[model samples]
Target: MYNRLTLATLASLPKTITRPRYAREALRPGILHIGVGNFHRAHQAVYLNDLFNAGKSHDWALIGAGIRPADRAMRQALEAQDWLTTVVELEPGANTAQVIGSMMGFVPVGEDARAIVNALDDPNLRIVSLTVTEGGYCIDPATGSFNPEHSDIVYDASHLDAPRGVFGALVAALRRRREWGLAPFTVMSCDNIPHNGSVTRDAVAGLAALVDPELAAFVHGSVAFPNSMVDRITPITTDRERTMLTERFGIEDKRPVFCEPFRQWVIEDNFPTGRPALEDVGVTFTPHVAAFELMKLRILNGGHAAIAYPAGLLGIHFVHDAIANPLVRGFLDKLETEEIIPQVPPVPGVDLHDYYRLIASRFANPDVGDTIPRLAQDGSNRQPKFILPVTRDRLESGADVTGLALETALWCRYCAGTTDEGEPFRLDDPNAARLTPAALAAKDDPAVFLNLRDTFGDLADAPQFCSRFGIALKSLWREGTRATLQRYLNDGF
Candidate 1:
């Protein structure tokens, strides 16, 4: 009983969650990870942990950093636990918990942003990785280019000495590294954006070009931005997750991460200076990461958007609950197999059917408890990346786009700021102010809504799409979400 009590006490503390058995002592910094969120914890950090556990590359432990104030809480939690995180993998019948110890330390964004830049400029730091969300890069969503004109970016561009944003911090740090004659760290992007490495390269290089052409040329020539395809459904942590960790696993990790059992990370093998031997731990270093990226983005993320708006309108709360609804599930499957898959170019050696099955299983993981609101948030940004790209592909190929058209209309109706019960709906997007107003105003004239050059751009003005989307939106407004979905399903569109 005494031994049991001691074990319980140790398990409850975050610091004692996972004690590395034979892992080597920390080595010099080789990687600087930005936006250390749950996905990074589950995906990249897991790979790094496996490498350390195998005694391969202990020198490359992670140094985590974040740009926003919310990241302060994460930094403090991890620092309290010595940068250890309890990763729980939820399987159908069993669950497993492993404490990941890849992160060595964290640097919070200070008022003047000196600390973050100093960390980045550290000669020991070799690879600078980012899981910063798509929006975090300050890319103009419609154009898929860096928005140098963005107020925050503009401010940072002018005030480079006192950098404010992540891009600014990166440029300042690179400048210091140049001054110190240290080789620039490879910038690897693990975000979900299509061609993420190139996107990040463009964002960084684009910003640098506006400030200093020579610096931009240096980055373009020396630094390697490797594209990657990452997949894992890591739900936001909640009180329930914390309690489960303590009660079920007897681990009290302050910043415990819960994720599905399935995980995938495919990276382009293009680190110029040096990188961790992550390939030793199931990280597929591929030349065809672009194909894999397109497959995941269109299939997984696209499926999420296809189901999210309709599920929200139907009052479904959790992802599993939404999937359990036969109507919603059937609609999603049809969209993938019939409409979406037809346009997706063949990804080498990937069985689309098997991929679809895997997606279904992942979405059905009740342990994840991913919320509809979380998926529904920022539809204005998500739809273009997840839904519209496929829609455009189908339309361009002259394929049937009725299902895709319905998906877009459902999204527009969802943004109208009210539910079927007439309760005020919440618009959870950065572009909410612009998108919501356009959506409301387009209630009578959809062309006006489509004209918001920011969200839809030219895609909104396509004649056939506009007509179909207009019809679907009008039907949804008159008949309600359920009836409109039922009509689309029964009518076999």
Candidate 2:
């Protein structure tokens, strides 16, 4: 039996639950990680925990920081346990539990980012890492570039001293560093954006330019934003997971992360100041993280987008269940093989088809318990990143976008916020309020949703794209999600 997990209970805990091998008290802070969520904890923290176990980079521990008020709950949960997190690695046959203590501290979330600003001033903090999701970057969907005119950017530019956003916090930190004559630390983005490094550099430099051109020049020159490709199948923590820990594993861990056995991190080896020796712990440091990024984003992420919306509309709850449906799985396979994969460039040492095969197997893993809701959330943000890029590639190449166009129309029907049975499932998204209205209007006028030119651009006006999309939307409403999917699978387009 195991009691609630805390540093004090480390001695009595079962040996099966892997504990940190190094001395926790001696571990010092080095990286300040923003957005300490499930993916970050499962993937990045696990790697650091491995390095700490290997007795390397003792000073390279993480100090978790949060900008959103919602993060306080995570802070309280972790701080209550002395910054320890229980990570359960879910494999095919068995699961393993491990306690990670690489994060020794946290910067409290607040309206003004002063706490994080002050934390960054410390010379020991050599890298500011973030996993703030793709939406957090504030890139305009019309163009794959940073949106400097975002309301947050405008607010931060004026209230630089009392800023609230991530870029605001970054600007404050760099300004402090420059005034104190400290060399600027590297900014590493672990998000799933194409050219995430360039996006980070653009957001920071763009905001800094508004504040001060000289400061912008300093930021543009001094900072090193390295692009990376990180992968792991981590699901939302459910009561089932908690019970599994308490009953099967004989441990009580609040907010424990459960993830797949596999993990991969491919990073561009560029940190001007310094970084963790993560390469020692199965992290691939390479120059062409872009290639890896494109491969993962298009093949894996696009695959998720392909199945996610239709799955949600069909009321499929779990990822495995969604992919298990013959129609859903067939749609994913046909779309990728016929339309998506051909546009992806050849990556070094990676067979694109083999990657797709790996993704297929990964999607079929039931132990991970990845939810369709998680994959389907934030369609306004996710579709642009995961699905639209492939559509654009096919469009540019003059390939038949019939499958891609149908996929977009399926997304349009999904946005209408109802299933074939007219059952109302809440559309969970940041833009749900606006998106729902546009989607509802599109029910009457098949092309109304396309007018949101910022997202669809001129493709909403293109005869081929719009016609296919309109047909798919009409069929989706008239027939149902399953019949529509079956039609597309049968090449009824």
Which of the numbered candidates is closest to the native, going by highest lDDT?
Answer: 2
TM-score of 1: 0.94
Candidate 2's C-alpha runs over 4 A off are none
TM-scores for the candidates: 0.94, 0.98
Which pairs clash (backbone N, Cα, C closer than 3 Å) in model 1?
none
Over the full model, what C-alpha lDDT does candidate 2 score relative to the true structure? 0.88
Residue lDDT tens for model 1, 1-493: 2111122244444443454443435545688888988899988888888888787787888899877776788898787766778898888568777777788889975665667888876777888889888777777767767788888678888888888777788888887887789999888898888898898888778778878999999889988899999999988888988888878777667778899988899999998787888887888989999889888998899888888888888888899999998878888998899887776678889998799888987898888889888888888777878888787777787776778888888787778877777777688888888878777777788777777777677787677788888888888888887887787778843
Question: Ten residues in a row with the worst lDDT in model 1?
Answer: 1-10
What does the lDDT read for residue 437 in candidate 2? 89
Highest TM-score scorer: 2
Each prediction's RMSD to truth: 2.7, 1.1
lDDT of 2 by residue, 1-493 (tens): 6678889998888877789989998898999999999999999999999999999999999999988876788998888998898999888788898998889988987767878988999999999999998899979987878898999999999998888889999998999999999989899999998999899999999999999999999988888999989999889999999998899788787889999888999999999888889999999999989899998998999898889888988988899998899999999999999888998999999999999999998998888999988888888887788788787777777788888887888778888888777878878788888788888888789778988877887777777788878888888888888999999988667
Error of 1 at 123 (Å): 1.8
